[model samples]
Target chain A: MFQTRLEETAAQVAAHLTHVLDGYPAHPVTDAMRYAVQGGKRLRAFLVMESAALHGVDPQQAMQAAAAVEALHAYSLVHDDLPCMDDDDLRRGLPTVHVKWDEATGVLVGDALQTLAFELLAAEQTHNNADVRVALVASLARASGAHGMVLGQAQDIAAETAGRPLTLEEITALQANKTGALICWSAEAGAVLGQADPTPLRTYATALGLAFQIADDILDVEGDAAKAGKRLQKDADAGKATFVSLLGLDGAKQRAKTLVLEAEAALSPYGDAAENLREAARFVISREN
Target chain B: MFQTRLEETAAQVAAHLTHVLDGYPAHPVTDAMRYAVQGGKRLRAFLVMESAALHGVDPQQAMQAAAAVEALHAYSLVHDDLPCMDDDDLRRGLPTVHVKWDEATGVLVGDALQTLAFELLAAEQTHNNADVRVALVASLARASGAHGMVLGQAQDIAAETAGRPLTLEEITALQANKTGALICWSAEAGAVLGQADPTPLRTYATALGLAFQIADDILDVEGDAAKAGKRLQKDADAGKATFVSLLGLDGAKQRAKTLVLEAEAALSPYGDAAENLREAARFVISREN
Candidate 1:
């Protein structure tokens, strides 16, 4: 039941994002922009909407935040796939943006998408309070920019040639910055936009984000490449660190369970206000890719 | 006199930026972060300060805007210098960030700097109104993101392999997006923060931005690489379109004068309120490097 709702929210957010992005100028850059944004699972968007729903925020308000988060996620993926970065040729069973439109366009499209995320939030109808809008913008900027995901990417790259396997704690730190920060921010942003207090929401999102990463690590190790729709075991091949690398497979699985339990516990204070979020935490750990 | 003021503002803003960036975690990534922010002509910052001065805004407020603009500018430069993009090795008489810190750190630092720009704006205490803060954030986002500098970079890369020489108009469009947009936005942002009417300020910034590019083209043709602190005549070697490439050096100079005149005219209604800006326009066209 939760899967159906997640899928619906993801689809709606993706469609809205496509419509908004289509309004850019019809140049070669636009072609790359389209390519970067067109194919994403919209998982982050789902998190935002689900978390907002758990807080009893209007779905429409949640959708706006979802769209912005999705745009940011799309932009990061585009840049991450560039030759100078991950050098990936494929993403989600399609040619990566850099492959389709050249590296420069890929870069620009990613940049534009980042800007578009802010633009969506700044629109008059997103929130009536200007302070709330500023807060949302600040939150998104921190998650998406250098101190957040960008720093994560930098650490990941530095890890490649550092001549030692990263500790589990270090790996967690990396994932927290790279994969977890935005996800955490997405949930908190939805709550903030919904007029919920951000302090507890942030704590909940952080734990949830780590759980999400643990699940991702497990899937990358165990899931089918075609099913995953992107390269798998690249982490192992690269000798990069992950939760699964530090903990044995069984140990990692056990840790993931613990993390999910902790995440659910973090949501407990919200009481009935967080039922969906609790369910989503369970879904995050148990689902197969 | 203008050069002295530009140098002083650049130094002051750089110092402020350095102080703020130093607070980050001390890591390899942080080193790259410092490298990206440490030095520049701070032309954008200068424009911001000068424009603010014209409007009777506190110079300190202008300094914050200048620092933010410089951060954005530095981030773009780092990303642009990556191997997948322009692939330049030298910047500001030092190795490019990618060359100094590896491609990943370079990318991350750029991302971090971009985020830091918004953060600085958000954290600024001077702008008491949330609406003004939102507008500043929105304007900077537009100038730096997909529709602005990023698009310009994309166009620049596309033009390289476009298999055709671009027309004068195409070059101008490229320059406007790549170089002019952020510079124009910097000036306009200062005015906005100063509570100056933004319409005329934007117009003035736009014309000045183009003139700045025209001057850059002329400099690339005649300036020494050592003095310019970046590669010279590489534009010609790459066959990248520019004002001087489309028009002869003399014609480019003439076009620059025309632009400066137009830029000056845009600020004329402000009378002496805009004298520094008018002088800056002339300085842009007449500077040696």
Candidate 2:
């Protein structure tokens, strides 16, 4: 049921994003962007909307943040799949943007998507309070800036050039910046929109994010190729470090379970309203891909 | 005298950008960002500061917008010079970002610098009014989004792949979106900060930007390589249609002069207060590089 809710949220976000992109001059960059964002788990959008629901923020008002996170997440995927970065040929069972269009389109699409995310948040439709909107803008910038996602990406690139795999602590730090930061932003956005306390959601997101990545590591070893879409176990093949490599498969699974539990417990303050978030956290490790 | 003022503003912007980047964790992306942002025209910064001055906006309060535009310009250049794009080896008589750093680092640095620009504009220091800050962020997103800068890039890339020269109107539209949009934003930023009508500055920038591009076309034909600090006449060599190619040498020069005059005339409403902007318009055509 929670999975269905996430799918529903994904659809909602997709529709909103389409509306947001309307009226732009049609170009390959826009086409690449559309293709890149077409399908995803929309986990970030789910987190934003669920988090907002728990805070009593109207979904209409929170849609911007929800869409914003998905847009940002999509941009990351587009860029990370570039020939210069991950060099992947497949994403969500479709050809990567660079492969489908061209590297120029890939780069510009990612660039535009990133800005479109910011533009969505900055628009008055997102929040009535200018202060709140600016805060959202500032927080997203921090979450995705050099101190955040970009920094994580650089470290990953550095590790490959260094010809040595990262250690556990380094991987954790790297993943925190790369994936965890955006997840945290999504979870906290609802609280921000409603001006509610963000501590509980922040805590929940930290554990949920770690669990999510651990699941990715586990799936690399165990997931069905057709379901995963992209190549699995590339990290292991490349001799790069990952949670499974660092903790052993069983150990990583165990840690993920503990984190999911912690993540669920963090939602206690919100009581029944946060049931969806708790289920979502549990879904992180349970999903096949 | 105008050259000296431009240098002074460049220094001021560089210092402010440095201060803004102070606490970011030291990494290759950060290093590349510093390297990429160092030593540029800083013409956009001058426009922001001079326009702010015309509106009696405090230079202190205006510094962030000035710095923000430069950071953004640096990002655009870094990405634009990537192997998939313009693929320049030299910029400012030094290695381009992808040449100086790896391609991955080049992409990350450009990505980070862009968000850093938004972060600076969203900061309270840019404007005391939350409304004003949000407006700045929104304007920037629009200026840099698909409808503006990225659309121009797509058109240019499309032209290259199309294997034919663009029509005069098409080149004009492409250049307007490419260089003109950001320049227009830079010229209008100060007015946005002061909450004043941006019509005069907008008009001034429209002509100045076209004239600026025309002059660049001229420089590519006649300027010394060492002075220009990058490959000149590459567009012509590539069989690209440019302002100079569309119009003859003398015709292009005559056009730039006419645009400069129009730019200066648009600044007349500010009287003596707009002298710097008028001078800037003249400088756009007169500079050798």
Candidate 3:
């Protein structure tokens, strides 16, 4: 049931992105933007839809925010894959935007994609309450900007040049900002829309985000390259410290499982309405990818 | 009077940006972001402030939006100067961000600055009314994203690879999107905040924007590099068609002067209250850089 619902949310998000993107003028940047956003797992979108359902917010309304998060995530990936950054050629089983198109297109497409995320949140169709729309934009900007995801990325880059391995605690902090911030925002979005206190969802998302990162670290070490749909073991190749490197593989696995349990417990306030989110937490650690 | 007011607006906007950016956690990316936004003409900021004042909006309330446009413009400049893009080495008489730091820092700084722009507009302090704040975000997104500034940039790139000079009409349309959209947005912002129709300012801005670009083209043809604070004549060297190239130097100057008149005439609705804006229109074509 969880798998079915997740896939459904993913499809809806993809369709919404296509429909929204279609309204823009045709340009190569637009094409590159479309290409870059095409194939993410849509876990963020799933979190958004499921959380909104739990809050009784209309799925269509939630879809706007869902697509916005996915768009923002896609922008980050496209930029991180640039030759000057991660320099990856493959992503989601396809050529990176910089590889398929040119670097300029890659840069512009990523930029335009980021702008599109805020555009989606600010539109009237996203929410009838202008206050909710502004809140969404503000929260997203905080999560993705200098204070959050970008800070993590800069720390990662700084760590690379420091000529020393990151400590376990340092890696955890870095990962929390790099990937966990957006994930937490996704889980808390429905509450923002519903005008409810988001403390519990925030707690739920915090654990879930950490578990998801630990799982990613585990995947880098042990997961199949084809199934993961991109290059694998990059952290080890770069001699970077990861959860699986700082902790033993078994230790990392244990930690992720514990985090999942915490995530499940945090959702207890919602009971069955949040069962899907609980399943999502479990899926984060166990998925092959 | 216009020059003094423009400089005054520049100082205030810079100070506001500094105060806001200082609140973010310290990091290398934050350093790069601050460096990137340090200096510019601040014409867009002036437009936002001047238009807001015309609408009787409080200056402090308008400062947030003013700072936001400058941040967005700075981000565009940083990205445009990337090695993979225009490959510029100097801007505002200082080394470009990538030249001062590295390409990775350049990319991240630009991304974060763009996020900061939307964050400023979405802040509660920008306005007491949520609808106005959302309107600002939505309009800015439209101006800067795939449909507006990015569209113009993509078109410019396409023209380069197509091995043909753009016609006069094509260049005008392209410029309308490139430098024009944000300027128009800045001009209309006060009206948006004031809950007044923006048609007059839009007309004024459209004419003002074209004249500004024509002045840029004229400067590219025959302006002191020291005064311009950057390289000039690269457009002619690259054989790219510009206003000065398409319509001779004399013709371009005449067209810019004519557009200044149109821009001034658009402000007739406001009488003496709009004299500063009228002066701004004249300054657009007359400034050295």
- Among these predicted structures, which one has the highest DockQ? 3
How well is each residue in A1-289 modelled by candidate 1, as lDDT tens digits?
6678777876798778777767766777666666666665576887788777766777776777788888888888888988878999989888898787677677667767777788777766677787878888888887766667877887788788889988988888988889888988887876787787777667777887888888888888998888777888889888888888888889888887887778778876678767777777788888766
Clashing pairs in 3: none
Ranking by lDDT: 3, 2, 1
After TM-score superposition, what is the CA distance of residue B60 in candidate 1 from its true location, in Å? 2.8
Where is the poorest 10-residue window by lDDT in model 2 chain B?
A: B14-23
The superposed Cα distance between candidate 2 and the true structure at residue A105, in angstroms, equals 0.8
Q: Grade the docking of candidate 3.
A: high
Q: Write the per-residue lDDT of candidate 3 for residues B110-155, one digit (tens) a residue.
A: 9999999999999999999999999999999999999999899889
Prediction 2 global C-alpha lDDT: 0.89
lDDT of 2 by residue, A11-72 (tens): 99888888777767887777677777788888899988988888788898798999888888
The residue-by-residue lDDT of candidate 1 on B1-289, one tens digit each, is: 7778878987899888888778776677777877788776777888888888777878777677788888889889888888878789999889998897777677667767877788777665647777877887878887877678887887787787889988988888988889888988888876788776877778888888888898898898898888888898988888877889888899989988998888889887788777767888898888766
Comparing 1 and 2 on TM-score, the stronger one = 2
TM-score on alpha carbons, each prediction: 0.95, 0.98, 0.99
Model 1 chain B worst lDDT window (10 residues): B120-129
- DockQ of model 2 vs. true complex: 0.90
